[model samples]
Target: MSNNHLTREELQDYVQHVFGASYLITQSARIHGGAQKVIYKIDCTNGFTCMLYVWDISSNYFQEEILNEPTFHSSYGSELFSLNTRFLAQHGIRTPILYDLNNDRDRHSYDFALVEYVDGQKAEAYFQHKNHKDRDELFQRIRDMLSNMHGIQRNVYGNANDNSKKAGPCYQVQRLDAETALSYASKHMKDIRKNDKRLLEKLCELEAAIQPRDLYNFIHGELGPDHIWIDHAMQPCLIDIEGAGFFDLEHEHSFLEFRFGDFYHYLKNNDLDPERMTFYRFCHHLSLISGGLKLLHRQFPDQQFARGLAEYHARCVVQMLS
Candidate 1:
């Protein structure tokens, strides 16, 4: 997740390779974080300035992205480019204006995608700066934007109630009943917390029902400080679009709780039905905890903090409501 180095010649070759040599005038700057690719700032002589993200990638990941791009896009896929596009537009999101792809060109090497650089500083940098006193205000702004996004009327995937798509619905999740989901995971998975199983039992007793196309429809899928930018006027914009697919809106509701260190205000902001929202929140937390356990079961898995604490927090929420 750190910058991998390439010589100026290599950069030039890459630019030329992606854009063709004659018209490609450029300077290179690096973007850093949990990002998997090399992001460079490229300036062309035609007054065209764009951002290039290259993945010196593994073939498996490369192929997956190429094949999955359409599915991602289809879940508000139209928002892939064009400034201020809807579906995921209007909510202060800024994503690379994807232009071209060099997908799966080389099997052993890497793949690259070209996009217009989002113009802004990382939102977290501004908010977390030692001297910045506006941290609370920035948080509120982000909260407002997310609340607005959740205001969308459509589901993330084409089918809001269909579970077959994996990333659809207000409660898609393959339309599994609580028992089946838990049984499948417990028998087939590992690295799970004991608390998750307990939480699921409580949730299943309540039998929360999901509604499609409700006011709280859209979900960010992933929401944390790492995936955003702030424009010149200090507007918040989301940069990472990889996890911007569909899911239960409860994901977004639980998202604020998961990252913001609190859940009360998030519930308040949406004018949420206290009883129903609380139930869904429990479901979301339990699901994430379950997911983390399954990931841990994988031979080589990425153990993330969010995933690790999911079960613990789910229990806390369950107790609060109970």
Candidate 2:
């Protein structure tokens, strides 16, 4: 394994030792996405096909200090992905079935999960080729799935679990009201925008306008296009759920609009509170800007493109706040 890249021989050894399988490895293809995780499609001679996800623990894509914050889920690695999959499954939501998890200290220190491979086009691409009626049906199906997920109520808000042992009601992050959530974002923003007093004051005004309330529900924290895969039967399957948790339901709509630009217009006809949605959108944009800056600072401080991207996200936050 060179710099966390697994070679064919190493993968075969893992299959033999961990899985107790002597089947010859046929093919392994890497799938690229966000920098935090590495994915591979592995096919074996034993007629087994699976996708392997390896969390890049060594990558400073997200600052170590921010990720290690006590309020967030600590196991935002392979273990959390598996747990989130199980959580969604309990709610009748389809996700990639996790086959096995390997976290051995000696062999491979990084977390890894082997999951059933679902062969189909990504939902975004699938929707683009479909007729209007079919696209509407797909959107309805997605809406129903989101409704089912949000239907599952939770008493507290925040990370689903901190550890991997016990499943339900195991250990949740403390409930967060609007004030508390905004305060946390403010802390991060201070570091990202050190001397930008004008921008900081605008952020404070946005935070003050938020009305504190207790609303907790299951939220697929990162419900972006790439994570939604459409199967051959045209059913939606959710993947890459490292950020899933129990949180404010409004945040879900915020994420949906942020990731899918058209969602904002679609949701305008729905029974959602416009002001609340706007507030959540502001919060989400601020979080992304702060988090992106921290990642750039830690990993690519001298890179101009990286700095530009961070500035772009910050501009989005400013627009939302306005």
Best candidate (score: TM-score):
2
How close to the true structure is residue 193 of candidate 2, measured as C-alpha lDDT? 45
What is the per-residue lDDT of model 1 for residues 1-322, given as tens digits with 9 covering 90 to 100? 1224446665566667766767455566665433234567777666667776665533122233335434222222222323223336455444555676655555325555567666667654653456444655665677677667666554235333332433444343422433443443455334223444564556654444543453335555556555667766666777655445444455555555555554235334554445455555665555554444544443223456534554564455446445
Residue 186 miss distance in model 2 (angstroms): 13
lDDT of all predictions: 0.51, 0.64
- The true-versus-predicted C-alpha distance at residue 220 of model 1, in Å, is 1.8
Clashing pairs in 1: 73-77, 160-169
Please list the Cα RMSD from the true structure of every candidate, rounded to 1 decimal place.
6.7, 5.5
Report backbone clashes per prediction.
2, 0
Q: Determine the C-alpha RMSD for candidate 2 after optimal superposition of all C-alphas.
A: 5.5
**Candidate 2 lDDT tens digits, 155-197:** 6665565323223221112222222334434565553345355
